[model samples]
Target: MKALTWQGINELAVKKVPDPHLQNTHDVILRVRRSVACGSDLHLLGGYIPAMEKGDVIGHEFIGDVVETGSGVQKLHVGDRVAVSSFMACGKCWYCKQELYSLCDNANTNPAITEALWGHAAGGCFGYSHAMGGNAGAHAEYIRVPYADGTAFVVPDSVADDRAVFASDAGPTGWMGADRGGVKEGDVVAVWGAGAVGQVAARASELLGASRVIIIDRFPERLALAGQFSEGVETLDYSQVDVDDALREMSGGRGPDVCIEAVGMEAHSEGVQNAYDQVKQQLRLQTDRTTAAREAIYSCRKGGSVFLLGVFGGVVDKFPLGAMMNKGLTVRGAQMHGPRYIPMLLERMARGELRTELFGTHVMPLADAPKGYELFKEKKDGCVRPVFVP
Candidate 1:
């Protein structure tokens, strides 16, 4: 099988690898149809997240056809087109029962690594890292999908592949940000980062009945796309305007009721703090950049909520604990619990409430994944999200 593999820090390649087969009673072998690059993949590409190895396949947001199914798989069979959640969860677990599927106890087969790192393992995600189960990623012709019945959802006939592919990760992840961030009717919501995740987060806020949705980013192209999310959506070019003042003005001098930070560890900011974060990250003193998170916390209204939809692997420096505590704000972060939101998101996609194909700004064959990653990583040619076809 041909798949994209991590060669080294800031390196990727297309190489032939062994094909996958059913590994568990609930597993299924999927012939991947589409897999999109995610912002979080950059962390792996840049060697920010530990436990990644040479030649490891590294993609998780995907849609595919089931090629083989294990005996215990009841809802899926050969030839079914489905979108699989990035997070793997055993449906019978306590966390799964509580709809916090990402915190499932039985998913991460390689638990000791993350358990040692974060005190406990959450769940396994395909192709993320050895710390997240070391499962081969979906950026290939085929992948082994464990817990198929719990993690895979059949794509509705009304939804196209490009649109359904996002339901695998970005859609659910963004929805989680707004849903868990406590977006309410008539609430003013602000989202940091206008990438795919941020775009979706803004749209999710609109769908959740936010009276206004403000998306912040420095890129002109990304901000332009975010502006078209909905009538209630607005975009702020962080390079041109002071985000703090602009958000306060938009929220009637009170700051937004909900703030979502969608940018992850590679988040860029200006000035001395940015330099400090960069040096600390390069020196391995901290594993993430908290610029967006700090800005979100600072910009959120008193008694408001902030949700972190971004992926952060390790400890970060200079988090805004004082403002968060003094303002009586609610702060939460999570890897998306896909099972709890994917079905509803797909239904929304079917109804044309969520249009995500536009996020696939660059489409290419699997053989060209290295170039695609270069374009995506550099944010070159207005690449929002690169979609790779297998």
Candidate 2:
């Protein structure tokens, strides 16, 4: 098997690797059909997330067909086309029973590492990092999926592979952001970062009855695409104006009812704070750039909710706790619970109520994954999300 492997900071390679075999009674081996690079993958590639090692396979968003299943797996079998969740959970766990799959207590093999960093360990995630779970990712020919019954959902025939692939991560993540952000009828929602997650968050806000959706970004192509695909969505070029002032004007002096920060630790910004964050990040004094997060908090309406859909690895400097306290704002965030929302998203896709095919702007073979990553990371040729057909 050939898979993308992390060699060093900003280094990736495609190399031959041993094929995966079922290791647990509930495990299955999946022949990957399609996989895509996620914005979060850049964290690992950029050395933001810790505990990653040389030669670690790195990808989480993917869809595949079951080639073999353990005897304990009853619901899924050979030849079943499935979309595996980015994270793994045991459905019988207490958190799982509460539908908080990302916080499942039984999945993370490296709990001590995460517990030291976050006060608690999250569930195992495919190909994220050693701290999340060292499971091989789907950017390969095949992968071993443990807890197959809980993690792999059979894709409906009506949903094309291109669309179904996103159900594994991006779609469910955005849906969770909107759902948890408490989007309501006629609410005004603002989302930062017009990438896949941001685009989907805006669309999900509309689906959940937000009357107005505003997407913010510096990229013209991404903003244009978001406005085009998500009906009623408006775009704001932060490069041209102060996002806070723009939001104030757009919302008629009141801030957005909900503000979502979809750009994570690597967020870029203008002015002195951006340079400060960059220098601090390079010195390893801070692990995140909080520009978008700060804007989200400051731009949100008083008493409104701010949802964080972006991935953050470590502590940030100069956070706006004062605004959150003074304004009585509600802040919520999570790693997406795929089992909680993948089914609903799939149903929407089946009914043609959701469209994600346009997100796959670049499609390449597995052999060309290195080039795909370069294009995606550099945002070359307007690459939004590059899908690798394995």
Candidate 3:
């Protein structure tokens, strides 16, 4: 089997590796049908994630077919199509009971809430940097997925792999943010960044009944795509226009009722890179990548909610905390608890309420991952969301 291994900053190579097998009773062996590069993978590649180890399989969102399942995995069987969750968690945990599966007690209740109340601490993560349970990754030909029946969701066979791919991460993350924002009919929504996550956020807002969606992105290409997914959505090229002014003008002197920040950790600082970075050879730090987050805060209406859906690991500066507090802005950040949303999102997609297919611009093979990662990092090649089909 071959998997893209992270050798160092901006260094990735396809190397022959041993295939994974069922390791735990709660585990499943998934054959990779499709996978894609996530922005978080860039963080790990750039050495921004401290605990990342060389040779760690680094990808989180992917849709796969179940090749085998452990004895305890009854919900899924071999040959079932499934979307793997970003995090593996036991279903019987205390937090899982509350729908806060990301903070599952038996998984990683670090602060100590009593073993009976919390259960066992987390053992590790799949494809995420070392700190999260370094449990291999799905970027390979096959992945050994733990907490299989508890989190692995069977994606509908009717949907194309590329369309269902984002369901593993961005699709559900977007839905979670829109749901958290409580988008209602006639709500003026603004999504900052036209990245995959941002695109999904805009589409999710539409599904949630936002009347006039406005998507802001500096990239004309992405903004154009954003306009297409959102119903008559006004596009703000923040590079050319003042975000606060444009958002205010569109909202009749008020700011957007709901603002979704999909630009994540890039919202903070330029993710300080070491001098040894070769990514710097092809990429120079564009400071505005850091501005859109604060811009999301600035363009938000008073008393409105700002939902952040980007990846983060380090400290950042220049956020308008005083303004957020003064205007009573509610801000929340999350990784999509996909297991909670996949079933419902599937139903919506089945009914055509969620138009995920429009957002997929590229469906290349897994072998072109370097090009995919480069373009995704540069927002080149009309890259909306690139899926790697193996």
Candidate 4:
């Protein structure tokens, strides 16, 4: 099988690797049909993710067709179309029962979900890092899917595979970020970083009936997508215009009622030249993903809510916490629990209530992944969300 392997810092290649076979009764085999590069992949690309090992496969969001199922897997069968969540959890864990799937006790107990009897924090995840169970991810011809019945959501036939791809990660992630903001009808919303995730968050706000959606980004291309997603949304080009002024104007002299920080530690801000300077002297692709997260806090309306959906594993510099406290705002971060929303989001996709495909400005084959990462990092226009076909 040809797996998109992350060999080391700033290193990636399509290499032939061993195929994944069933390792446990609950395991299943998936032949990946499609996948995409996410901003998080920059962590792997820049070697910022600490748990990652050399030669690790590093993508989390993907969908595949089931080629085989383990004996204990009853909910899924061969030939089923499914979207795999970034994380896996045990159905019967303390956290899983509470709907905090990331904290699933059983999933943390073992390297492979069904191979052991206790809990470990490392849930079996594909294409993540060594700390995430070191499993090969969906950036391959075929991947071993653990806890298939728990993590893989059966995508409906009504949705095209291109659109269905986002449900695995960015789409639902954006949906979850917006929901975490607790947006209400006619409320004002501001979203930072108009990348695929940020664009979707603004769209989610629109779906929730937000009266105004303000998007912040230096990249005109993604901000344009935010505009296309909703007429209510206004763009703030952080590169040219001042964000504080833009937010004040858009929110009637106040900041947005709800602010979503879709760009996490990967965000770039003023003063910091590049986020990856510690790892290498190269220009940091993660700068936009992290720096934008901090700006959302400063630009949020007083007493508003801020949701942090972007991935930031390490320390970030220049976050203005004093302003957040004085503003009396609520700030939180999250990872999307696909099972919680994939079915509903998929239903909405079926109904056309979510036109997230507007963010899919580019779609190419899996072989073009390295270029996709480069383009996404550069914020290339007409390539908002690029999916790779294997």
Q: RMSD, model 4, all Cα superposed?
A: 4.1
Q: Candidate 4: lDDT over CA atoms?
A: 0.76
Of the two candidates 1 and 3, the one with more favorable lDDT, higher being better, is 1
lDDT of 2 by residue, 1-390 (tens): 999999999999999989999888999999999999999999999999999999999999999999999999988989999988898878999999999999988878889989999999989999998999788999999999988899999999999999999999999899898999999999999999999899889999999999889999998899889867788899999989999988988887999999999999999998888899999999999989989999999999999999998999889998999999999999999999989988888899898777887889999998899899999999999999999987
- Once fitted onto the true fold, the runs of candidate 2 whose alpha carbons sit more than 4 angstroms away are none
Residue pairs of candidate 2 with colliding backbone atoms: none
Ranking under lDDT, best-scoring first?
Answer: 1, 2, 4, 3
Instruction: Give per-residue CA lDDT, model 4, range 1-390, as digits (tens).
Output: 777788788778877888889989888898887888887877778766656776776688888999999999999999999988877866877777777665556654335532332233544556777656677888888888878888888888998887788888887788888887899999999888787788788888998989988887777667767767766778887778778887888789988889898776655655445534333323442233356666678888889998998876644445678988999989987666667777788888888766766666677777887777777767665566667778
How close is every model to the real structure, measured as TM-score? 0.99, 0.99, 0.88, 0.89
Better of 2 and 4 by lDDT: 2
lDDT of 2 at 63: 94
Model 3 Cα displacement at 126 (Å)?
2.6
Worst 10 residues of 4 by lDDT: 279-288
lDDT of 4 at 146: 79
Candidate 3 lDDT, tens digit per residue, 310-380? 76553444568998999999988766676788888777766766667766677777777777778877778
Positional deviation of residue 384's Cα in model 4 after best superposition, in angstroms: 2.5
Q: Global lDDT for candidate 3?
A: 0.74
What lDDT does candidate 2 reach at residue 30? 96
